[model samples]
Target: MSRIGKKPVSLPSGVTASVDGQTVRAKGPKGELTYVVNDEVLVQLGDDGIKVDPRDTSKDARAKWGMSRTMISNILTGVKDGFEKRLEITGVGYRASMQGSKLQLALGFSHDVLYDVPEGIQISVPKPTEIVIVGIDKQRVGQVAAEIREYRGPEPYKGKGVRYAGEKIVRKEGKKK
Candidate 1:
Protein backbone atom coordinates (compact mmCIF):
# COMPACT_ATOMS: atom_id res chain seq x y z
CA MET A 1 0.00 0.00 0.00
CA SER A 2 1.17 3.53 -0.75
CA ARG A 3 1.41 5.67 2.34
CA ILE A 4 0.68 8.91 0.53
CA GLY A 5 -2.18 7.41 -1.47
CA LYS A 6 -3.82 5.99 1.59
CA LYS A 7 -3.87 9.25 3.49
CA PRO A 8 -7.20 11.07 3.46
CA VAL A 9 -7.34 14.64 2.15
CA SER A 10 -9.03 16.92 4.65
CA LEU A 11 -11.57 19.24 3.13
CA PRO A 12 -11.55 22.85 4.19
CA SER A 13 -14.66 24.73 5.35
CA GLY A 14 -15.31 26.72 2.17
CA VAL A 15 -14.00 24.27 -0.38
CA THR A 16 -16.39 22.13 -2.42
CA ALA A 17 -15.25 18.91 -4.05
CA SER A 18 -17.13 17.06 -6.75
CA VAL A 19 -16.30 13.97 -8.72
CA ASP A 20 -17.90 13.68 -12.15
CA GLY A 21 -17.09 10.54 -14.05
CA GLN A 22 -13.30 10.66 -14.52
CA THR A 23 -12.89 14.30 -13.57
CA VAL A 24 -12.61 15.76 -10.12
CA ARG A 25 -13.29 19.46 -9.54
CA ALA A 26 -12.41 21.47 -6.46
CA LYS A 27 -13.65 24.98 -5.81
CA GLY A 28 -12.70 27.27 -2.97
CA PRO A 29 -12.05 30.88 -2.01
CA LYS A 30 -8.93 31.21 -4.11
CA GLY A 31 -10.08 29.47 -7.27
CA GLU A 32 -11.27 26.24 -8.85
CA LEU A 33 -9.21 23.43 -10.32
CA THR A 34 -10.16 20.25 -12.20
CA TYR A 35 -8.18 17.07 -12.69
CA VAL A 36 -8.87 13.90 -14.66
CA VAL A 37 -8.86 10.80 -12.49
CA ASN A 38 -6.75 7.91 -13.73
CA ASP A 39 -8.43 4.75 -14.98
CA GLU A 40 -7.11 2.51 -12.23
CA VAL A 41 -7.85 4.97 -9.45
CA LEU A 42 -11.12 5.37 -7.53
CA VAL A 43 -12.01 8.30 -5.32
CA GLN A 44 -14.40 8.19 -2.37
CA LEU A 45 -15.59 11.36 -0.67
CA GLY A 46 -16.24 10.73 2.97
CA ASP A 47 -17.99 12.95 5.49
CA ASP A 48 -14.70 13.93 7.05
CA GLY A 49 -12.27 13.73 4.12
CA ILE A 50 -11.54 12.29 0.67
CA LYS A 51 -10.08 8.84 0.10
CA VAL A 52 -8.38 7.29 -2.92
CA ASP A 53 -8.14 3.63 -3.79
CA PRO A 54 -6.52 1.49 -6.46
CA ARG A 55 -8.69 -0.75 -8.59
CA ASP A 56 -6.19 -3.60 -8.71
CA THR A 57 -2.98 -4.79 -7.07
CA SER A 58 -1.02 -4.43 -10.30
CA LYS A 59 2.04 -2.20 -10.57
CA ASP A 60 0.43 0.25 -13.00
CA ALA A 61 -2.65 0.56 -10.82
CA ARG A 62 -0.54 1.27 -7.79
CA ALA A 63 1.36 4.01 -9.61
CA LYS A 64 -1.86 5.56 -10.89
CA TRP A 65 -3.36 5.44 -7.43
CA GLY A 66 -0.54 7.53 -6.00
CA MET A 67 -0.57 9.99 -8.87
CA SER A 68 -4.32 10.46 -8.72
CA ARG A 69 -4.25 11.06 -5.01
CA THR A 70 -1.50 13.64 -5.35
CA MET A 71 -3.32 15.45 -8.12
CA ILE A 72 -6.49 15.68 -6.06
CA SER A 73 -4.58 16.88 -3.04
CA ASN A 74 -2.89 19.56 -5.07
CA ILE A 75 -6.19 20.74 -6.44
CA LEU A 76 -7.68 21.02 -2.98
CA THR A 77 -4.69 22.91 -1.60
CA GLY A 78 -4.44 25.15 -4.63
CA VAL A 79 -8.02 26.36 -4.41
CA LYS A 80 -7.66 27.11 -0.72
CA ASP A 81 -4.27 28.81 -0.28
CA GLY A 82 -2.91 29.03 -3.81
CA PHE A 83 0.81 28.83 -4.72
CA GLU A 84 3.69 31.21 -5.04
CA LYS A 85 7.23 31.35 -6.46
CA ARG A 86 9.81 33.98 -5.66
CA LEU A 87 12.76 34.91 -7.85
CA GLU A 88 15.70 37.18 -7.15
CA ILE A 89 17.80 39.04 -9.67
CA THR A 90 21.51 39.03 -8.86
CA GLY A 91 23.90 41.39 -10.63
CA VAL A 92 25.16 44.94 -10.49
CA GLY A 93 22.30 46.38 -12.56
CA TYR A 94 19.91 43.44 -12.80
CA ARG A 95 16.40 44.34 -11.79
CA ALA A 96 12.73 43.63 -12.48
CA SER A 97 9.58 45.75 -12.57
CA MET A 98 5.92 45.28 -13.41
CA GLN A 99 4.17 47.39 -16.03
CA GLY A 100 0.47 46.70 -16.37
CA SER A 101 0.34 42.96 -17.10
CA LYS A 102 3.96 42.57 -18.17
CA LEU A 103 7.18 42.01 -16.27
CA GLN A 104 10.13 44.09 -17.43
CA LEU A 105 13.47 42.55 -16.64
CA ALA A 106 16.90 44.10 -16.92
CA LEU A 107 19.30 41.18 -16.85
CA GLY A 108 22.41 42.75 -18.45
CA PHE A 109 20.84 42.53 -21.87
CA SER A 110 21.25 45.37 -24.34
CA HIS A 111 17.46 45.79 -24.31
CA ASP A 112 14.99 45.19 -21.52
CA VAL A 113 13.20 41.84 -21.73
CA LEU A 114 9.43 42.13 -21.46
CA TYR A 115 7.57 39.06 -20.23
CA ASP A 116 3.81 39.12 -20.48
CA VAL A 117 2.08 37.75 -17.41
CA PRO A 118 -0.66 35.31 -18.23
CA GLU A 119 -4.17 35.49 -16.82
CA GLY A 120 -4.83 33.88 -13.42
CA ILE A 121 -1.20 34.64 -12.46
CA GLN A 122 -0.13 37.64 -10.43
CA ILE A 123 3.29 39.21 -10.68
CA SER A 124 4.57 41.58 -8.06
CA VAL A 125 7.92 43.32 -7.67
CA PRO A 126 8.44 43.97 -3.99
CA LYS A 127 11.93 45.23 -4.74
CA PRO A 128 13.94 45.87 -7.86
CA THR A 129 15.71 42.55 -7.43
CA GLU A 130 12.81 40.53 -6.03
CA ILE A 131 9.87 39.10 -7.97
CA VAL A 132 6.86 37.21 -6.62
CA ILE A 133 4.55 35.07 -8.70
CA VAL A 134 1.19 33.98 -7.31
CA GLY A 135 -1.49 31.73 -8.75
CA ILE A 136 -4.04 29.09 -7.80
CA ASP A 137 -2.62 26.54 -10.22
CA LYS A 138 0.73 25.13 -9.15
CA GLN A 139 1.79 24.13 -12.65
CA ARG A 140 1.14 27.55 -14.14
CA VAL A 141 3.01 29.36 -11.37
CA GLY A 142 6.03 27.06 -11.78
CA GLN A 143 6.01 27.39 -15.56
CA VAL A 144 6.01 31.17 -15.43
CA ALA A 145 8.85 31.27 -12.95
CA ALA A 146 10.87 28.77 -15.01
CA GLU A 147 10.42 30.78 -18.19
CA ILE A 148 11.59 33.94 -16.49
CA ARG A 149 14.58 32.23 -14.95
CA GLU A 150 15.49 30.71 -18.31
CA TYR A 151 15.98 34.17 -19.79
CA ARG A 152 19.20 34.47 -17.81
CA GLY A 153 20.20 31.43 -15.81
CA PRO A 154 22.44 31.81 -12.79
CA GLU A 155 26.08 31.88 -13.72
CA PRO A 156 28.83 30.04 -11.87
CA TYR A 157 31.30 32.89 -12.14
CA LYS A 158 29.68 36.12 -10.89
CA GLY A 159 26.35 34.43 -10.17
CA LYS A 160 24.62 37.16 -12.13
CA GLY A 161 21.21 36.15 -13.45
CA VAL A 162 17.73 35.14 -12.31
CA ARG A 163 17.29 32.45 -9.67
CA TYR A 164 14.89 31.34 -6.97
CA ALA A 165 15.05 33.20 -3.72
CA GLY A 166 17.79 31.86 -1.39
CA GLU A 167 19.15 29.62 -4.15
CA LYS A 168 22.95 29.22 -4.06
CA ILE A 169 25.25 29.12 -7.06
CA VAL A 170 28.67 27.57 -6.71
CA ARG A 171 31.38 29.76 -8.21
CA LYS A 172 34.10 28.07 -10.27
CA GLU A 173 37.69 29.22 -9.97
CA GLY A 174 39.15 31.13 -12.86
CA LYS A 175 42.23 29.96 -14.84
CA LYS A 176 45.59 30.72 -13.30
CA LYS A 177 47.52 33.58 -14.85
Candidate 2:
Protein backbone atom coordinates (compact mmCIF):
# COMPACT_ATOMS: atom_id res chain seq x y z
CA MET A 1 0.00 0.00 0.00
CA SER A 2 3.05 2.22 0.27
CA ARG A 3 3.92 3.98 -3.00
CA ILE A 4 7.58 4.32 -2.15
CA GLY A 5 7.88 0.66 -1.22
CA LYS A 6 6.09 -0.38 -4.41
CA LYS A 7 8.70 1.23 -6.64
CA PRO A 8 11.87 -0.83 -6.96
CA VAL A 9 15.12 0.89 -6.07
CA SER A 10 16.98 0.93 -9.32
CA LEU A 11 20.69 0.25 -9.21
CA PRO A 12 22.76 3.19 -10.39
CA SER A 13 25.77 2.78 -12.61
CA GLY A 14 28.97 1.69 -10.83
CA VAL A 15 26.90 0.42 -7.94
CA THR A 16 26.45 -3.25 -7.09
CA ALA A 17 23.82 -4.40 -4.64
CA SER A 18 23.12 -7.75 -3.04
CA VAL A 19 20.65 -9.17 -0.57
CA ASP A 20 21.51 -11.68 2.17
CA GLY A 21 18.53 -12.71 4.19
CA GLN A 22 17.23 -9.44 5.64
CA THR A 23 20.47 -7.54 5.08
CA VAL A 24 21.26 -5.51 1.97
CA ARG A 25 24.78 -4.61 1.00
CA ALA A 26 25.86 -2.13 -1.65
CA LYS A 27 29.28 -1.38 -3.07
CA GLY A 28 30.20 1.49 -5.34
CA PRO A 29 33.00 3.85 -6.26
CA LYS A 30 32.58 5.82 -3.08
CA GLY A 31 32.54 2.94 -0.58
CA GLU A 32 30.51 0.04 0.79
CA LEU A 33 27.47 0.23 3.01
CA THR A 34 25.00 -2.25 4.50
CA TYR A 35 21.51 -2.09 5.92
CA VAL A 36 19.50 -4.68 7.82
CA VAL A 37 15.89 -4.64 6.75
CA ASN A 38 13.24 -5.03 9.37
CA ASP A 39 11.66 -8.44 9.82
CA GLU A 40 8.23 -7.04 9.05
CA VAL A 41 9.45 -6.18 5.57
CA LEU A 42 10.45 -8.51 2.76
CA VAL A 43 13.40 -7.51 0.63
CA GLN A 44 14.72 -9.06 -2.55
CA LEU A 45 17.24 -8.24 -5.26
CA GLY A 46 15.43 -8.45 -8.57
CA ASP A 47 16.71 -7.93 -12.06
CA ASP A 48 15.02 -4.54 -12.23
CA GLY A 49 16.39 -3.53 -8.84
CA ILE A 50 15.77 -3.99 -5.14
CA LYS A 51 12.16 -4.72 -4.27
CA VAL A 52 10.57 -4.24 -0.85
CA ASP A 53 7.20 -5.37 0.42
CA PRO A 54 5.36 -5.82 3.65
CA ARG A 55 5.54 -9.31 5.06
CA ASP A 56 2.11 -9.03 6.62
CA THR A 57 -0.96 -6.84 6.41
CA SER A 58 -0.53 -5.58 9.95
CA LYS A 59 -0.07 -1.87 10.56
CA ASP A 60 3.43 -2.35 11.92
CA ALA A 61 4.46 -4.29 8.85
CA ARG A 62 3.06 -1.65 6.55
CA ALA A 63 4.82 1.09 8.43
CA LYS A 64 8.16 -0.67 8.14
CA TRP A 65 7.78 -1.49 4.46
CA GLY A 66 8.50 1.99 3.19
CA MET A 67 11.20 2.65 5.79
CA SER A 68 13.02 -0.56 4.86
CA ARG A 69 12.90 0.32 1.20
CA THR A 70 14.24 3.79 1.86
CA MET A 71 17.07 2.39 3.96
CA ILE A 72 18.13 0.17 1.09
CA SER A 73 17.95 3.11 -1.27
CA ASN A 74 20.05 5.23 1.07
CA ILE A 75 22.80 2.62 1.30
CA LEU A 76 22.97 2.35 -2.49
CA THR A 77 23.24 6.08 -3.01
CA GLY A 78 25.64 6.50 -0.10
CA VAL A 79 28.11 4.01 -1.48
CA LYS A 80 27.84 5.46 -4.96
CA ASP A 81 28.10 9.18 -4.26
CA GLY A 82 28.52 9.58 -0.50
CA PHE A 83 26.80 12.39 1.45
CA GLU A 84 27.61 15.95 2.48
CA LYS A 85 26.12 18.34 5.04
CA ARG A 86 26.84 22.04 5.38
CA LEU A 87 26.39 24.14 8.51
CA GLU A 88 26.36 27.90 8.87
CA ILE A 89 27.48 29.64 12.02
CA THR A 90 25.74 32.94 12.69
CA GLY A 91 26.55 35.27 15.59
CA VAL A 92 29.05 37.84 16.73
CA GLY A 93 32.50 36.24 17.14
CA TYR A 94 30.99 32.85 16.19
CA ARG A 95 33.18 30.79 13.88
CA ALA A 96 34.50 27.27 13.20
CA SER A 97 37.93 25.86 12.45
CA MET A 98 39.62 22.52 12.15
CA GLN A 99 42.26 21.64 14.72
CA GLY A 100 43.75 18.47 13.28
CA SER A 101 41.00 15.83 13.69
CA LYS A 102 38.94 18.00 15.98
CA LEU A 103 36.53 20.82 15.11
CA GLN A 104 37.08 24.00 17.08
CA LEU A 105 34.06 26.20 17.55
CA ALA A 106 33.90 29.65 19.11
CA LEU A 107 30.24 30.46 19.80
CA GLY A 108 30.56 33.28 22.36
CA PHE A 109 31.32 30.75 25.07
CA SER A 110 34.02 31.51 27.59
CA HIS A 111 35.84 28.34 26.52
CA ASP A 112 36.04 27.13 22.90
CA VAL A 113 34.18 23.91 22.13
CA LEU A 114 36.31 21.17 20.62
CA TYR A 115 34.50 18.26 19.04
CA ASP A 116 36.36 15.10 18.18
CA VAL A 117 35.69 13.92 14.65
CA PRO A 118 34.35 10.41 14.27
CA GLU A 119 35.79 7.67 12.15
CA GLY A 120 34.85 7.38 8.47
CA ILE A 121 33.77 11.04 8.50
CA GLN A 122 35.60 14.16 7.42
CA ILE A 123 34.92 17.70 8.62
CA SER A 124 36.19 20.87 7.03
CA VAL A 125 35.82 24.60 7.45
CA PRO A 126 35.96 26.39 4.12
CA LYS A 127 35.24 29.71 5.85
CA PRO A 128 35.19 30.93 9.41
CA THR A 129 31.37 30.74 9.46
CA GLU A 130 30.94 27.58 7.37
CA ILE A 131 31.41 23.93 8.27
CA VAL A 132 31.27 21.02 5.86
CA ILE A 133 30.84 17.37 6.80
CA VAL A 134 31.33 14.51 4.37
CA GLY A 135 31.02 10.77 4.71
CA ILE A 136 30.00 7.67 2.80
CA ASP A 137 27.35 6.69 5.33
CA LYS A 138 24.31 8.91 5.10
CA GLN A 139 23.15 8.31 8.67
CA ARG A 140 26.53 9.01 10.17
CA VAL A 141 26.95 12.13 8.07
CA GLY A 142 23.60 13.47 9.20
CA GLN A 143 24.21 12.52 12.84
CA VAL A 144 27.53 14.33 12.88
CA ALA A 145 25.93 17.45 11.48
CA ALA A 146 23.14 17.29 14.04
CA GLU A 147 25.56 16.96 16.94
CA ILE A 148 27.49 19.94 15.70
CA ARG A 149 24.33 21.99 15.39
CA GLU A 150 23.21 20.98 18.86
CA TYR A 151 26.31 22.52 20.36
CA ARG A 152 24.84 25.96 19.71
CA GLY A 153 21.40 25.67 18.22
CA PRO A 154 20.01 28.69 16.41
CA GLU A 155 17.71 30.76 18.61
CA PRO A 156 14.53 32.30 17.27
CA TYR A 157 15.25 35.72 18.76
CA LYS A 158 18.23 36.74 16.60
CA GLY A 159 18.70 33.40 14.87
CA LYS A 160 22.23 33.31 16.21
CA GLY A 161 24.24 30.09 16.55
CA VAL A 162 24.91 27.09 14.28
CA ARG A 163 22.25 26.11 11.77
CA TYR A 164 21.81 23.95 8.72
CA ALA A 165 22.37 25.59 5.40
CA GLY A 166 19.18 27.14 4.00
CA GLU A 167 17.24 26.26 7.15
CA LYS A 168 14.53 28.84 7.83
CA ILE A 169 14.18 29.86 11.45
CA VAL A 170 10.85 31.30 12.53
CA ARG A 171 12.02 34.48 14.19
CA LYS A 172 10.07 35.54 17.26
CA GLU A 173 9.44 39.18 18.11
CA GLY A 174 11.20 40.54 21.15
CA LYS A 175 9.34 41.87 24.21
CA LYS A 176 7.86 45.32 23.52
CA LYS A 177 6.10 47.85 25.67
Candidate 3:
Protein backbone atom coordinates (compact mmCIF):
# COMPACT_ATOMS: atom_id res chain seq x y z
CA MET A 1 0.00 0.00 0.00
CA SER A 2 1.31 3.40 -1.02
CA ARG A 3 0.48 6.31 1.21
CA ILE A 4 0.75 9.00 -1.43
CA GLY A 5 -1.12 7.00 -4.04
CA LYS A 6 -4.10 6.51 -1.74
CA LYS A 7 -4.72 10.23 -1.46
CA PRO A 8 -6.65 11.68 -4.39
CA VAL A 9 -5.31 14.89 -5.89
CA SER A 10 -7.56 17.84 -5.13
CA LEU A 11 -8.41 20.29 -7.88
CA PRO A 12 -8.17 23.87 -6.78
CA SER A 13 -10.53 26.62 -7.90
CA GLY A 14 -10.12 27.83 -11.49
CA VAL A 15 -8.47 24.56 -12.43
CA THR A 16 -10.05 21.78 -14.51
CA ALA A 17 -8.71 18.25 -14.96
CA SER A 18 -9.74 15.44 -17.24
CA VAL A 19 -8.66 11.91 -18.03
CA ASP A 20 -8.59 10.46 -21.54
CA GLY A 21 -7.29 6.96 -22.12
CA GLN A 22 -3.89 6.86 -20.43
CA THR A 23 -3.33 10.57 -20.61
CA VAL A 24 -4.39 13.07 -17.95
CA ARG A 25 -4.75 16.69 -18.94
CA ALA A 26 -5.11 19.75 -16.75
CA LYS A 27 -6.16 23.22 -17.77
CA GLY A 28 -5.99 26.34 -15.65
CA PRO A 29 -5.61 30.12 -15.80
CA LYS A 30 -1.86 29.83 -16.27
CA GLY A 31 -1.84 27.22 -19.04
CA GLU A 32 -2.51 23.57 -19.86
CA LEU A 33 -0.40 20.43 -19.38
CA THR A 34 -0.79 16.73 -20.01
CA TYR A 35 0.80 13.53 -18.72
CA VAL A 36 0.52 10.01 -20.06
CA VAL A 37 0.24 7.58 -17.22
CA ASN A 38 1.93 4.22 -17.26
CA ASP A 39 -0.05 1.02 -17.88
CA GLU A 40 0.98 -0.40 -14.52
CA VAL A 41 -1.22 2.16 -12.78
CA LEU A 42 -4.84 3.09 -13.22
CA VAL A 43 -6.00 6.71 -13.26
CA GLN A 44 -9.39 8.23 -12.78
CA LEU A 45 -10.86 11.71 -12.33
CA GLY A 46 -13.35 12.27 -9.55
CA ASP A 47 -14.96 15.09 -7.61
CA ASP A 48 -11.95 15.40 -5.34
CA GLY A 49 -9.53 15.41 -8.27
CA ILE A 50 -7.48 12.55 -9.69
CA LYS A 51 -6.99 9.08 -8.25
CA VAL A 52 -4.32 6.50 -8.98
CA ASP A 53 -4.16 2.83 -8.27
CA PRO A 54 -1.95 -0.10 -9.09
CA ARG A 55 -3.31 -2.61 -11.55
CA ASP A 56 -1.85 -5.53 -9.62
CA THR A 57 -0.01 -6.11 -6.36
CA SER A 58 3.46 -6.30 -7.78
CA LYS A 59 6.71 -4.46 -7.15
CA ASP A 60 6.59 -2.64 -10.48
CA ALA A 61 2.94 -1.68 -10.04
CA ARG A 62 3.54 -0.47 -6.51
CA ALA A 63 6.58 1.51 -7.60
CA LYS A 64 4.62 3.28 -10.31
CA TRP A 65 1.58 3.93 -8.16
CA GLY A 66 3.02 6.73 -6.08
CA MET A 67 5.01 8.18 -8.94
CA SER A 68 1.96 8.32 -11.20
CA ARG A 69 -0.08 10.07 -8.55
CA THR A 70 2.70 12.57 -7.94
CA MET A 71 3.08 13.22 -11.65
CA ILE A 72 -0.63 13.91 -11.95
CA SER A 73 -0.49 16.25 -9.00
CA ASN A 74 2.47 18.07 -10.49
CA ILE A 75 0.70 18.69 -13.80
CA LEU A 76 -2.35 20.01 -12.01
CA THR A 77 -0.32 22.32 -9.83
CA GLY A 78 1.91 23.33 -12.69
CA VAL A 79 -0.95 24.35 -14.95
CA LYS A 80 -2.53 26.28 -12.12
CA ASP A 81 0.40 28.03 -10.43
CA GLY A 82 3.53 27.09 -12.40
CA PHE A 83 7.05 26.60 -11.00
CA GLU A 84 10.10 28.73 -10.34
CA LYS A 85 13.82 28.17 -9.64
CA ARG A 86 16.45 30.66 -8.50
CA LEU A 87 20.23 30.48 -8.92
CA GLU A 88 22.88 32.54 -7.15
CA ILE A 89 26.38 33.24 -8.46
CA THR A 90 29.16 33.45 -5.89
CA GLY A 91 32.36 34.03 -7.85
CA VAL A 92 33.67 37.58 -8.07
CA GLY A 93 33.76 37.79 -11.85
CA TYR A 94 31.02 35.21 -12.45
CA ARG A 95 27.71 36.80 -13.49
CA ALA A 96 24.67 36.31 -15.72
CA SER A 97 22.81 38.53 -18.16
CA MET A 98 19.86 38.24 -20.51
CA GLN A 99 20.31 39.00 -24.20
CA GLY A 100 16.81 39.07 -25.61
CA SER A 101 15.88 35.38 -25.60
CA LYS A 102 19.37 34.19 -24.70
CA LEU A 103 21.15 33.94 -21.36
CA GLN A 104 24.80 34.96 -21.20
CA LEU A 105 26.92 33.64 -18.36
CA ALA A 106 30.43 34.67 -17.37
CA LEU A 107 31.97 32.02 -15.12
CA GLY A 108 35.67 32.90 -15.02
CA PHE A 109 36.22 31.16 -18.35
CA SER A 110 38.25 32.68 -21.14
CA HIS A 111 35.00 33.37 -23.00
CA ASP A 112 31.37 33.90 -22.02
CA VAL A 113 28.92 30.99 -22.15
CA LEU A 114 25.71 31.62 -24.07
CA TYR A 115 22.57 29.58 -23.42
CA ASP A 116 19.53 29.74 -25.68
CA VAL A 117 16.14 30.06 -24.03
CA PRO A 118 13.67 27.31 -24.83
CA GLU A 119 9.99 27.77 -25.64
CA GLY A 120 7.44 28.12 -22.82
CA ILE A 121 10.28 28.84 -20.36
CA GLN A 122 11.30 32.30 -19.19
CA ILE A 123 14.73 33.15 -17.87
CA SER A 124 15.46 36.45 -16.15
CA VAL A 125 18.54 37.95 -14.61
CA PRO A 126 17.37 40.42 -12.00
CA LYS A 127 20.96 41.10 -10.88
CA PRO A 128 24.24 40.08 -12.38
CA THR A 129 24.53 37.32 -9.79
CA GLU A 130 20.88 36.25 -9.64
CA ILE A 131 19.15 34.03 -12.19
CA VAL A 132 15.44 33.29 -12.11
CA ILE A 133 13.77 30.53 -14.13
CA VAL A 134 10.01 30.30 -14.49
CA GLY A 135 7.74 27.95 -16.42
CA ILE A 136 4.48 26.07 -16.24
CA ASP A 137 6.07 22.66 -16.60
CA LYS A 138 7.88 21.64 -13.42
CA GLN A 139 10.23 19.16 -15.12
CA ARG A 140 11.35 21.61 -17.78
CA VAL A 141 11.88 24.40 -15.27
CA GLY A 142 13.98 22.19 -13.02
CA GLN A 143 16.00 20.80 -15.92
CA VAL A 144 16.85 24.27 -17.17
CA ALA A 145 17.92 25.36 -13.72
CA ALA A 146 20.12 22.28 -13.36
CA GLU A 147 21.75 22.90 -16.71
CA ILE A 148 22.51 26.47 -15.75
CA ARG A 149 23.90 25.46 -12.40
CA GLU A 150 26.04 22.80 -14.07
CA TYR A 151 28.00 25.55 -15.84
CA ARG A 152 29.92 26.34 -12.67
CA GLY A 153 28.95 24.00 -9.89
CA PRO A 154 30.08 25.03 -6.42
CA GLU A 155 33.51 23.77 -5.37
CA PRO A 156 34.11 22.63 -1.79
CA TYR A 157 37.44 24.38 -1.41
CA LYS A 158 36.53 27.98 -2.31
CA GLY A 159 32.77 27.55 -2.73
CA LYS A 160 32.98 29.80 -5.78
CA GLY A 161 30.42 28.87 -8.39
CA VAL A 162 26.73 29.00 -9.34
CA ARG A 163 24.33 27.25 -7.00
CA TYR A 164 20.64 27.15 -6.22
CA ALA A 165 19.33 29.74 -3.82
CA GLY A 166 19.43 28.63 -0.19
CA GLU A 167 21.72 25.68 -1.06
CA LYS A 168 24.49 25.19 1.50
CA ILE A 169 27.83 24.00 0.20
CA VAL A 170 29.99 22.14 2.69
CA ARG A 171 33.34 23.89 2.64
CA LYS A 172 36.44 21.69 2.82
CA GLU A 173 39.36 23.02 4.84
CA GLY A 174 42.44 24.03 2.91
CA LYS A 175 45.63 21.93 3.09
CA LYS A 176 47.66 23.12 6.04
CA LYS A 177 51.38 23.66 5.61
Clashing pairs in 3: none
lDDT of each: 0.92, 0.94, 0.94
Best by TM-score: 3
Candidate 3 residue-pair clash tally: 0
In model 1, where do residues sit more than 4 Å from their true spots? Answer: none
For residue 79, what is the lDDT in candidate 1?
Answer: 97
Prediction 2 global C-alpha lDDT: 0.94
Candidate 1's C-alpha lDDT?
0.92
| TM-score computed on alpha carbons, candidate 2 | 0.97
| Predicted candidate 2 versus true structure: per-residue lDDT over 37-57, tens digit per residue | 888899888999999999889
Alpha-carbon deviation at 117 in model 2, angstroms: 0.7
Between which residue pairs do clashes occur in model 2?
none
Each candidate: RMSD: 1.1, 1.0, 0.7
Q: What tens-digit string does per-residue lDDT give for candidate 1 at 1-177?
A: 899998988888899998787788899999889998888888888886888899889999998887788888888999999999999999999999998889999999899999999999999999999999999998999999999999999999888899999898999988899
Ranking the candidates on TM-score from highest down gives 3, 2, 1
lDDT of 2 at 12: 96
- For model 1 the local lDDT of residue 65 reads 84
